[model samples]
Target: MDVLQIVAIGLMATVLIGVLKSQRPELAVLLSVAVGVILFLLVLGKIGSIVDIITDLATRAGISMVYLGTIMKIIGIAYIAEFGAQICRDAGEGAVATKIEFAAKILIMVLAVPIVVAVLQSLLKLLG
Candidate 1:
């Protein structure tokens, strides 16, 4: 399975990172990022299928594509930000990781604003 492959790659990378950490810390960090990217790419295919399914459901529900798009963007930002933060943390840069997380939160909030407003409007309409 793909998850098994991902786990194996991750375990191998972890071992290599451990070995390289003492002699070549920089390379260890680079290896971490490379493995992360590789894993992300592997799962990227599944993401497309998931997006297609969600899109179909949204269409059937008569939901606006704009909101769906915004939600997808938010999820993307969250995942990307977390990925970046984890990389920073792996490199022993906790401060940088925190900043990355904060920035991601801000971006997610910005993306969610329109959805929140739309929901509020719908609620108001129902109440009225």
Candidate 2:
């Protein structure tokens, strides 16, 4: 998970995609998708470790699992949305990318409502 290695690979892929785009646009799109998947796979192990750390910290802090789960879902949605949006953009579908981003934001807001409500309830209890 070296940043430099990932950057190098990305730069190489960009060059290859650029070279292929004129001659075989379909292949270029496939190559971009492949690179995105590969990059995501490379980071999955790191993501797992991060999740473990967060879970452990939450447990130690006596935080509600529901809150932790919601946070994780929100983070997952953000990453997935960004990934989809970037892929769409790479394929020259800016409108589709924007739509994906907009949908993701809406989903994130929906997921966050529970947490917000919980906080507001706690504040009301304290004030009362």
Candidate 3:
């Protein structure tokens, strides 16, 4: 973990939050949200690197790229859902955030259906 990066972001967020609460509330709110989004983007780059590594490993192991892709999609959905939910909560919209989480879960399940079916079929073939 990059402690310095985390500390820098934390300090920035804290200062902005304090500024927002005391004076220039509107700008403070915007600053907080902008900071959140910037952090998310930075983490997303790391996630992309992880996905690339997974794809490389899967290729080496002769696993289907489609399966790897599905897994990565699931990870992305989770990250996005969490990011959105946290932002909403931070913005004082807990109810909306919960709904967003629910929607994301449903979408993930729907997307996984085909992958599940494929896995089941592959298993049955192996057994037979």
**Whose lDDT is greatest here?**
1
Descending-TM-score candidate ranking: 1, 2, 3
2 or 3: which has the higher lDDT?
A: 2
How far residue 114's Cα lies from its native spot in candidate 1, in Å, is: 0.9
Candidate 2 backbone clash number: 0
lDDT of each: 0.94, 0.93, 0.82
Q: Roughly what TM-score does model 1 have, to 2 decimal places?
A: 0.93
Candidate 1 per-residue lDDT, tens place, 1-128, comes to 88899999999999999999999999999999999999989998888899999999999999999989998999889999999999899899999999999999999999989889988999999999
Give lDDT tens digits, candidate 2, residues 46-98: 98888899999999999999999999999999989999998899889999999
The reply for model 1, stretches above 4 Å from the true place, is: none
Of 1 and 2, the candidate ranking higher by lDDT: 1
- Which regions in candidate 3 have their CA more than 4 angstroms from the true location? 1-3, 22-29, 43-48
Candidate 3 lDDT, 8-51, residue by residue in tens: 99798987788676777667667777887777666766777877
TM-score of each: 0.93, 0.89, 0.79
Descending-lDDT candidate ranking: 1, 2, 3
